[model samples]
Target: MVRAGARFMATGPAQSFLRRYGWRIDRALIKATKGHLSMSMVMPEVLLTHTGAKSGQQRSTPLTYFTDGGRVIVVASNYGGVRHPAWYHNVKANPRVTLTSRGYRGTFLGEEVLGDERDRLFELATQFMPNYAGYQKTTQGRRIPVVAFTEVR
Candidate 1:
């Protein structure tokens, strides 16, 4: 079921649909479930709250994520869109973020992974979600950005 959903979401129409409205739907569901659930239930999800790069207002985005030791890894694939997702810009502007995942909510520091470390994390992420490779292929050569969020204590 999860694989089917991933395949469906990788389609052009589904990608467009998700880019248009997936975040809003996922945000509500994640919040309502107190972070225990989301549209990508089996795929580990998180609600990332960040200060908007332009508006400065707080914005929340639900994203598929993977755990890397003590950090949470998320990709700004935007479903293979040519442009990076807005949240990526927000995180770049404000490294401080809040995340709600798997019934846990906390403040975190977001860092953009790069170079060999980025490559390693991306490979790990791809192993967890093979659809990411297809997403990368559709990206028209734009290397997707990966962000790691470490809980801020």
Candidate 2:
């Protein structure tokens, strides 16, 4: 994670450039570190594995996450893009998922929070990542979804 005060967030255009390509770099670091470091100082991240909604193929994405009791919370921000991310659709199609983070692996089920609950989670997420507030502002009516990955017994 990029430290809060770090100059990780550059200017608008720079940030946009990073948003487009930084994931590949982060993914390599994550692989090398075995999830020990996600390369973002802003917040911790988890590598989420799920089946593709359309292709029915397995896919993985590294995403920043927040802890909530026994569940892990994640936002489908997609860097404030207009459309919901592909992973979001995959999670919706098949809630079952695997999360690898910090030398731990777990089986979990993804569920989207809605309405009041989503609002609460959004607020909580903004606390961890102030950038989320900006992401929300650009979204207008298209809400960035907040999802919880709960462990399965």
Q: Could you tell me every candidate's TM-score relative to the true structure?
A: 0.93, 0.89
Top-scoring candidate (TM-score):
1
Q: What local distance difference test score does each model get?
A: 0.89, 0.83
Q: Candidate 2: misplaced stretches above 4 Å?
A: 1-7
Tens-digit lDDT track of model 2 for 1-153: 443522355358757766787777777777678788876755687999899999999988888898887789999988777888899999999999998888788899999999998898899888777777777777666789999999988
Residue 126 of model 2: what lDDT?
Answer: 84
Expressed as tens digits, the lDDT of each residue in 1-153 for candidate 1 is: 667767777787877777888778999999999898888756788999999999999999999998898999999998878889999999999999999987999999999999999999999888777788888998899999999999989
Clashing residue pairs in candidate 2, if any? 1-40, 1-41, 2-40, 2-41, 2-42, 3-41
TM-score of candidate 1 against the unseen true structure: 0.93
lDDT of 2 at 78: 80
Candidate 2, 117: how far from true, in Å?
1.6
Q: Write down the RMSD of candidate 2 (Cα, Å).
A: 2.1
Best by lDDT: 1
